[model samples]
Each structure stands twice: as structure tokens, then as C-alpha cells.
Target: MPIVKNLVTQMSGQIQVESQLGKGTTFTVELPFQSAEQEEHPCGGTLDNPVSLEGKHILLAEDNAVNMEIATEFLTMNGMKVTQAWDGQEAVECFATSLPYTFDAILMDMQMPKLDGCTAARQIRALSRSDAATVPIIAVTANAFAEDMAATTAAGMDAHISKPIDFAALCCTLGRLIGKSSKN
Candidate 1:
């Protein structure tokens, strides 16, 4: 409930929750937006361009099998190598045990059974490895809120991507974070 409210507020929207005993709860969300009359970039210059992830290694931590598969497929399609971890604890362990710079980046899910994403990120950041402080840690989460973004940043994540993940945004973010540019 709080997460929903935070997400609404983060999007410059409002949410009202009404609850009655023995009944149910109703959530009202109001979002402000302007209508788009035409395509902003009809030629699709940047949209048509492919983002290269060649030779980049990504550590992906996701508990859901379906999500993990989909994310992995997307990354592989973009030419990136992916290593999967089912939970945050495993993710932390993987990062800890790996050589410095073994992974170019980490795509972390916020919620998990063992340790949560924030805790895992903190653990990774605290490690003595040279890449611990340098590797890009990105939060791939369903929690799309200002507070959520703040929390990820505080936990040493480099960026945040909301679920029903945007592949283009993911690519752009990865490219920017790793100092690579998408090909035109």
C-alpha cells in the first residue's frame, strides 16, 4: 500500500486509500499527463539503432524463473554474457568469490527470499576487491518510486530500472554506465 502510494507520488500523481472493516480497500490514483498528438521521433533514428553489449559480463539476480529467463534472453540477444543468481545471498556470494572485474555490471532485483537487493549491494560495496567500488550495480525492480530510487542509490547501486523492463532504457543505461555508446 505504501509502495503504491510512493510510486504514485513519484510520478507526480496522487493516491487515496479507503478501507472499511469487513469490506475491502479501494485505492484511487490520479496521474497528470499531456496528450501526444504526433510521434516525437518518427524516423526512429535512435530507436532503430542497436546497443552493443559485446564482451560485457552481467551478473543478474532474480528469484522468478520466468523473469530471469526473459532478462537473460534479452541480454544475450544484445551480445552480453549473463550469470544468474536466484537470490540476493547467492548474488553477494558470487560477487565476493569472483575475481576483481569478473563482472562488468550487476542487474539486481530488489525483492528476494534470502538477503534483499539493498543489503546485497551494500555487501558488495564493502568488499575489499578493486571492482567492488567501481562495478556498476543496477537495480531492476518493480518498485518504481522516488523512495525506491533513493534507497538504491544509498545502497551503492549505480542506476534503477522498473519492471516490465524497458530493454531500450536498459541498453542505454548500460551503455552510459560502462562508457559505451549505442551504434547508429
Candidate 2:
């Protein structure tokens, strides 16, 4: 007889597998549902002074040093903790090796050395871990167009923000994903 068991996590159901006699065996685990702790947005209302992004952790992947510096300063000033990668490859590597659920959101640059944002995002979505796949990835690129938006969305990004990033827009995007409203 083959021994069997069931397990569940915070965003899915139980996954099971079996083995054969004198052979190898395997199993699958389903993730449980994630708890939505925050309340739904009240559409178009000036969010109660907007939500403060204080202490939130953000991962920024941009190959440009100047842009990275500017973004880092902006996010830090708003009380967010920022971790940066110089290119898309680094971003994928970081995400793959992170200490489980370590990121609140990711700001991905479309063009980079080694790997572009699209490929990196697709890889991230295919990760074996649930959180890795579910974490919000927001594309930050200079390509502002309808086609660009469609491409990014198809590549697994949760949202898209054009470059020369607008401070207000960035705040709004962050708020929507993490369940906060613009504080500024």
C-alpha cells in the first residue's frame, strides 16, 4: 500500500500524489487562499489622506544607475524600504532566491542586460512558489503606448507605469496593489 497525505496553505487546496512499487513516487501541494486584510477601495473618493507606504518593501530593477538613484530616494523618503537590481537577470535571480514572501511589490524596468522585463516576469510567474508568482510586478518603462501596455500585461505584470515616473502615479499604483490610497 502507498502512504498518502493532504496539505493546504493560505491560498489554495490540498494536492496529492502517489508512488509505485519498486519505483519512484511524487506528490503535489496546493496553496491555500491568501487573506485580504484590507478593505476594498471606495472608488474616486480622496482616500483618507491616502495610505502611507511607510515600512513597505519594494524591489526595483533598472539598469540605469541615475534612474535607480532617483527612484530609491523618492521611495525611501516616503518611508518605503527599497532593494534594487541593476538588470532584469538580477531581478529574476533575486526573486528566485529571496527569503520567502520578502517583497511587497516589484518595479521592473522593461529593457535590461542579460534578460528583458518580459522574459523575467514570465519566469517569475512560473516559479514553484505561490508568493513568487502572486507578488505584484509593475512594469516601469519608457515605452508608453497601447501595445506596450498589452504586452506587459500578457507577460505577467500586474500593472504598468511609464518612465520619467510620475510621483503621484507611482503612489497610486502602489496603493492599489497593496491596498492603500495615495498619501500625497
Name the TM-score of candidate 1.
0.72
lDDT of 2 at 23: 95
Best by lDDT: 1
Candidate 2 lDDT by residue in tens digits, 51-162: 6678989999999987898899999999999999999889989988998678888999999999999999998888898577678899999898999999999999989988
Alpha carbon lDDT at 88, candidate 2? 89
Clash totals in order: 0, 9
Relative to the true structure, how large is the alpha-carbon lDDT of every model? 0.85, 0.80
Question: Ten-residue segment with the worst summed lDDT in candidate 2?
Answer: 1-10
Write the residue-wise lDDT of candidate 1 on 31-67 in tens digits.
Answer: 9855453322222344334445788999999999888
RMSD of 1: 8.2
TM-scores, one per candidate: 0.72, 0.71
- Mark the regions of model 2 whose C-alpha exceeds 4 Å error after superposition: 1-48, 180-184
Error of 2 at 128 (Å): 0.5
